[model samples]
Target: MQSSVEAIFAPQPAPEGYAEHIGTGLTLRRSASRANAQQVHQLRPHVVEMAAQYDRLTMPVEIIHGDADTIVPMHIHAEELIKDIPNGALTRLPGMGHMPQHTAPQAVVDAIDRAAARAGLR
Candidate 1:
């Protein structure tokens, strides 16, 4: 969907499929949704509790992760998640670290856009 709210000044224009969250910080990322750090704070408590539900999700999931992610090992997190999620897929960034969105913004956008299209969002 096109952004109903037009963007003005930003650290950089949020790339396609991404939105800039300028509230707590001018952070930008396309997480398959418009959730920013502030919004995440509210859901933090429930995230761990919801992990078990990933396997039960029927929605298509696209995981764009880094092969070198030490913080959350790709094999452990992304690989395992893709296996669990019924309609899930994964794209790995060869040399990237933990933050694929920051290290490979365009790639992240492309992956998210594909996922959104599959989910009928774009």
Candidate 2:
């Protein structure tokens, strides 16, 4: 992550107008908030179909989420992903925000190591 971008999301004292976009040259294009809402709107039937596909594939899976993240709600993504898989687990990190690799590298590495153990990769 860029220093300026990370600095923008850092915890800080409450300030008026502080939440305004902080950078000009940054370019990020993920599915829009509008698209996310649409996807969530279509969740139920989508999940049923997705679960069927997952069951057919029979793939092992794991999900990692930062509990304090606001940008992408962990419960919304990781919880659903875990629910979709037969033998999947979701790990939620306490006190970490948006990106654990940036906010808590050691914890992220530890999670990876544990995942590796689960996959017999270690």
Candidate 3:
């Protein structure tokens, strides 16, 4: 389990707090009671169909993705999102991994702030 989680961080060392959080989340997702885990994993297949409704999304979206992330495929989530959404902005962090909010909290914050401005919320 540690090795699998380690791969998600890759070249970067996982910060202790974030690592623990991620590990706990992973444990929960894999537990027998987490029935919705499959539903979350299965969402990728519906992105194209769901994206057809992107025009109705009346708010801004900010996708902060790591180029090096191996957990969730970038093509399925971030790339597809930034391409399909009219008001979507992407911050692609090179050499970063899955946990951008931890490794680059400021970048995440900046993205949120940008999204807020775009949505007229800031």
Worst 10 residues of 1 by lDDT: 4-13
Query: RMSD (Cα, Å) of candidate 2?
Result: 6.9
The order by descending lDDT is 3, 1, 2
Instruction: Kindly report which residue stretches of model 1 are placed more than 4 angstroms away from their true locations once superposed.
Output: 1-49
70 Cα displacement, candidate 2 (Å): 0.9
Candidate achieving higher TM-score, 1 or 3? 3
- Candidate 3 lDDT over residue span 1-122, tens digit each: 66766777775777777657655555655564366777788887696688789867768888888888888767768997787777777888998888887788999889989988887888
Candidate 3 pairs with clashing backbones: none
| Model 2 Cα lDDT, one tens digit per residue, 5-100 | 554444322234333543333333354556767878988897677667874544446567777767778777787777767767677887666766
Q: Relative to the unseen true structure, what is the C-alpha lDDT of residue 95 in candidate 3, on a scale of 0 to 100? A: 84
Estimate TM-scores for all models: 0.58, 0.56, 0.76
Which one wins on TM-score? 3
Cα miss at 26, model 3 (Å)? 8.0
Candidate that would win on lDDT: 3
Q: What is the C-alpha lDDT profile of model 1 across 48-94, one tens digit per residue? A: 67877878898878898777666677888788778878888899888
Better of 1 and 2 by TM-score: 1
RMSD of 3: 3.1
